[model samples]
Target: MTTYDYLIIGHGIAGATLAHELRRRGRTVLVLDTYQTDSASNVAAGLMNPVAGKRFALAWRADDFLTAAATFYRELEQRFGQQFFFETPILKLFSSVAEQNTLLARSADHPWQNFVEELAPSLPPAPGVRQDFGGVRIRRGGYLAVRELLVALAAEGLEQGWLRRETFDWNQLVVGPASASYAGDVHARRVVCCEGAAAVHNPYFDWLPLTPNQGEVIDVECSGLADTQVLNKGAYVLPLGAARFRVGATYRWPPFAEGTTEEARAELSQRLASMTDQPFVVLAQRAGVRPAVRDRKPLLGVHPATPVMSILNGFGSKGVMLAPLLAGHFADVLEGHAELWPEVNILRYHALYVAARKEGGFSS
Candidate 1:
């Protein structure tokens, strides 16, 4: 049997980042993934904005997360000889006078002053864009080519013979006091589940309040759209080169299945139209389910009852920025160097797990 220090399930941002971090720390790791093309990480536009929401408030832990994410992606670029990370400014268009005023006021505030700046007139104008009230230029913002990055990471893992392309069966997992064996052939000191939205069906973690959300995005060929900066208002218009842009996304709760819908396409197209007058042709549409949680925080750390089994999921839409920082912390916890953050610890749902067990069973 092949032995490893860690066995990770899923190859999305969470699993890929964690595997990279653990391997960097000299751990023997094995990654198993079915590599579903419609996974959230595959379809995500990878926008890493420091400030978000219609109110222009800074994202949670924006400073720390942005700094770590930037450094991590840059290092990955150097290592892989690829250009997937783009550090571009985000042009946050104002939909109303109140929104613009709120942004201006916040720009002058303490922490916001560091990242928020008034849109400079010197910047090239976005033709056909609706900017009657103008917009603020947010610094320390950018995007990663999530799909490309995942492909590169998976290639490296495969080349090293540490990544397998297959579905991981939960019933095949045998958890011991200090180790777990998968398929009765692969043995690992610990198993980390990063199965994304699929974790809702995981018997070990189904009780953790994972609310899978289906999100859709469309690829459009807009000839006149500017690629200088990411355009955002109600929806985002991310330039993907070749006169193409990725416009997304519509969130649907209780997603029955993973597939694109006409409703989502219409929603995205309408949002895109509201943001710009540039005529565009929709080239393709894609859909995936994000591993969202009830509290909107990432779920991490070892399982309460099974010490050998752990999790690093529930990143929702912010995986691009959250993955690197959280992966480092999780690796530290796995190495006995730190503890899981209280808010994100799976132990927070211990009572729910017990209740489910008592009630005969729970449905994911």
Candidate 2:
């Protein structure tokens, strides 16, 4: 039998970040992942925007999240000798005068001062882009090459004998008073599930309001577009070097399948057309499901009945920015150095789970 301090399921952003944080604290950890092709982290554009939406409101804890994420990704780049993070500005094109007024108001506020900057008229027009109502430049924003980063991290973990490629079987998980055993071969003090949308089928956590949202992105090659910064209007167009760009995405509830759809392609095409008049060749289209929660916050902490089992999931679309900070907090809680935030704690749904179990909605 093999033993470790913790066993993590799923190697998406959440699992990978938490595993790294735990290992940095000198804990013995093993990560298991099936490498699902349609996982959100694998397909996400990895955009980190502090100010989002037409309202130009600041994201929750924007400053803290951005600062922590910058430090975390930079350290990983140095450790792995890979360049995956880029600090690029996001040019948010205004669609109407109301939108411009919103930006002006936010720029004058204290909190938004550092992140929102007004572009000067001296700057040249973005090639192949339309700026009918002008635009504002957003600072401290960029995209992460998520797939590349995961591949590098997985290679490192495998080299260290701490990561395995395999499907996790929940039926084989046996939780005891102080520890848990999996597959009758691996034992650990704790088992943390980062299984994304797959958590809907997990017996211990099926009671959670995990709504899977399907999204799609299109990869296109534009020959003459010169702008490298991210462009956003109704949708985002992210440059991926060498005249290639990634544009996405559409959110639909109850994602029926894991494949791309024509409806999504047309939606993305319309959004791309809305941003620019440039001609481009469509290289590819991809789709994935994001695990969103009813409360629109992350779900973290231990199971009420099983102290040896825990979870870190439901980050939705902001996983790229939120994972690093929340993972560190989870590590601290695991080490008994801190506690889980009330809003994100899984204990908030204990009553719901209990009720479901009593009604035979779930099996023990």
Candidate 3:
């Protein structure tokens, strides 16, 4: 039989980050992951941006999130000796003068103004690209190598005797008010679930209003495109290491099929064709359901009824940016060193679920 001070489930960015934070605090932790065939972290582009979309509003808690995230990743990279983050400028191509004006006007007053800069007026026209709409450069943003980081952390955890590469069985789990345990020949003081969309099946924390959106990205081997830049035009064309680029992220409110759909492939093909002049080969296609909430915020904290069981998910598309900060906060809360952020605390969602249950409507 084996015992640990803490147990973490799932190997996604959220789980990996949390495990690292706990380990740094010198806690004996065990990470249990089933290595699900379909995983969000494995397919994530790991883009960390302070702003997104047409509105160009600042990402929620951009300052704190970015600072904490960058610092966390830098420290981890130094410790692990791997490149996890790269500060790349994102070129957001505008569609019309009105859009560019909207961004420029907001840039003056927005906190992320420094991130927005004007590109060269003599920028050459790109074939199959909308050049009439000038582009806005967003500095201090870039992508994380999500898969590599997760793998490295998993290996580190294993070497430290803190990783279990197996499926966690609910039947062997005991949930209590102050602590959780697994009774199947192994024991742990506390168990935290980081299972992405599968958290829906969790008996305790499933009440949160989660709108899972499915998205897909395609890998293309293209040359002559700028390096270390994410070109955003509706969908982003990200420069993957080597000469390959990732073009995608088609959002489907409710996923139609379990895997990549033909429609999505065709849609991506069309979008990529319009993004560059060079003939690109579609190397691969992948999909994952985002665990986004209605308000587009993450859900973190202890379970209201089952305090023994806790969850750290709902990172959605911002997992890479939010994980480092939220994971540290969560560790503090668990260790009785600090409190949870109200914005991300699951209490509000639990309240909404209670109200909805009384009204005979689904919580989400």
Predicted structure with the largest TM-score when compared to the true one = 2
What's the true lDDT of residue 177 in model 1? 87
- Candidate 1: worst-modelled 10 consecutive residues by lDDT: 117-126
> RMSD for each model, in Å, please?
2.1, 1.7, 2.9
Candidate 3 lDDT tens digits, 57-163: 77877888888988988987998888988878887777677786776666656776766766432245654454566777788788888888888888877777778
**TM-score between candidate 3 and the true structure:** 0.91
Between the candidate structures 2 and 3, which one is better when assessed by TM-score?
Answer: 2
What lDDT does each candidate get? 0.88, 0.88, 0.79
**Model 1 lDDT per residue over 128-194, tens place:** 7777788878888989999999999999888889999999998898888889898978999999999
Candidate 2 whole-model C-alpha lDDT, 0 to 1: 0.88
For 1-364, candidate 2 gives per-residue lDDT tens digits of 8999999999999999999999999999999999887899998999999988766768889989989999999999999888888889998888877776666565655476688766432235878887877887889999999999999999998998899999998788888989989998899999999989888988878888888998899999987765579998888889999899999878889836659998888988888877787888889999999999998899998987778888999999899899999999999998899989998998898888889888887645
Off by over 4 Å in 2: 119-124
Note the clash tally of each candidate.
Answer: 0, 0, 0
Give TM per candidate. Answer: 0.95, 0.96, 0.91
